[model samples]
Target: MKRILVPTDFSAHAENALKVAAQVAKKNNSEIILLHMLELPHQMNDAITSGASIPETMLFMKKANETLDEISNRNYLDGIEITEIVKMDKPIHGITQVSKEYEIDLIVMGSHGASGIEELLIGSNTEKVVRNSEIPVLVIKKENPDFSASEIVFASDLSEEAYLPFEKLLKFAKLFDSKLHLVTICTPNSFKPTHEIEKITKSFISKFDFSNLETHIYNDTNIENGIINFSNSINADVISMCTHGRTGFAHFFNGSISEGLVNHAIKPVLTFKV
Candidate 1:
């Protein structure tokens, strides 16, 4: 049976992710694992000792349990087993640890599109989990629930790591009966039509029996703009890419393509660790 791991923070976005995971599990006949990682601030314990009355931690756990109970009682997941895991640690660390321990096949989480100071300081937990975990991470943009992913757009540089997640992506495409669109952007300076690219694309497609697979190559100056524009042109339901989680000087000026796509894309952006 397929095991789906969903990490929740009890936010509306996380709850939406849980709902999506349930739909996916019901469709695939898989079990759902509802995980919540509680990373209490450093002052949490101190506040308690200082009589600040920080019961919010307990409240979070209680709400998580209640939500899990609600999901379990749903008629859609009648036979599918539902498990709840509550951990006190950083969200990304907890997610990665649970994914390894449980051998999770897929991870579903929500992204709030963090930006500016918040993003610069802590970075994105979703991005961190995507970079650290070996499993497939599906990030749902909370604004676009009505958008069912009928077409999946994959942005790749044709790197070795890019191909590693194809197995999982193909499985997901088959499960959803969605069309797969593989795209690679070539800049003016990087413009070179090589046989290797063709071979790689063909070999990848040959492995899948999908009837609705399309490959495209775009010549553009900005990679991010190319991806976003192509996705918009095709009206893709979802976009998938591999993130390296680069930071510091390299990241400050160049910025992260995956984070930029997630922040700008109107559709769901599913990221897999390379």
Candidate 2:
């Protein structure tokens, strides 16, 4: 991982994420792209593209740049190369565009869940980013004063197609020397006998060369609930998952469970599309 794109609205939650990003950058010597986006007033939205003549857009951009300057110069960000970006665009679009344009290797953002959106709108947009971004996303839900990825829980169906994302997960886990806990959620509706579940789990992993790993089969009422409960039980530092874009988790038929977890998981969530 090289450039980490952190989209900020200058909220407390966003600052929480920046603190975490500083930690990550120090460890990896990566560049931080701190982006601030403005969804201008309806009348000024089109005018923003014309030039810097519009007063509203200009004012917001100046304020955003000043705020970015303040954030970039903080003691916590000292010695770290930061590229502050200010643009007139929606948060999600700006993030995606910058991620691609800069060839961002990872995206880190903070959230206070969907419930806290009134005071932290940018924080809550983590759901939209997790639902859409192709690049790996690491979400910070709250202030993790002493963040470390010692234990990571990766919930998946262990399908053959899952190997690709798992490979990506492995690279991330190795960053912090995190031990991977690979879990397969066994739900009541899709219940299987213990031996059958083990047989499948073992078969899927047998073909791969994985080290510093443990396998598990957790039972619960549903996939999302199962994942959350299992992760909490282990006190995992991070919850990793794969989603099929808008269709939600590849294992789920419903179209919202992936974001549901992203919006609700108390621990940080690391997600990417399959």
Highest TM-score scorer: 2
| TM-score versus the correct structure, for each prediction | 0.78, 0.90
For candidate 1, give the lDDT of residue 121.
13
Q: Write the per-residue lDDT of candidate 1 for residues 50-113, one digit (tens) a residue.
A: 8675677677668767876776686745777788887877877888888888889888877665
lDDT of each: 0.70, 0.80
Residue 112, candidate 2: how far off, in angstroms? 1.0
Task: Please identify model 1 stretches exceeding 4 Å from their true place.
Answer: 46-80, 114-123, 143-147, 194-211, 245-258
What does candidate 2's lDDT look like per residue over 1-274, in tens digits? 7899988888988888898889899899999999988777776766666765577766788888999999999999999999999987778788889999999989988777545422343743555777688898887878877888899998877777577778888888888899999887888776778898788788877876768889998998888788889999998999888766756555432444544565567888888677
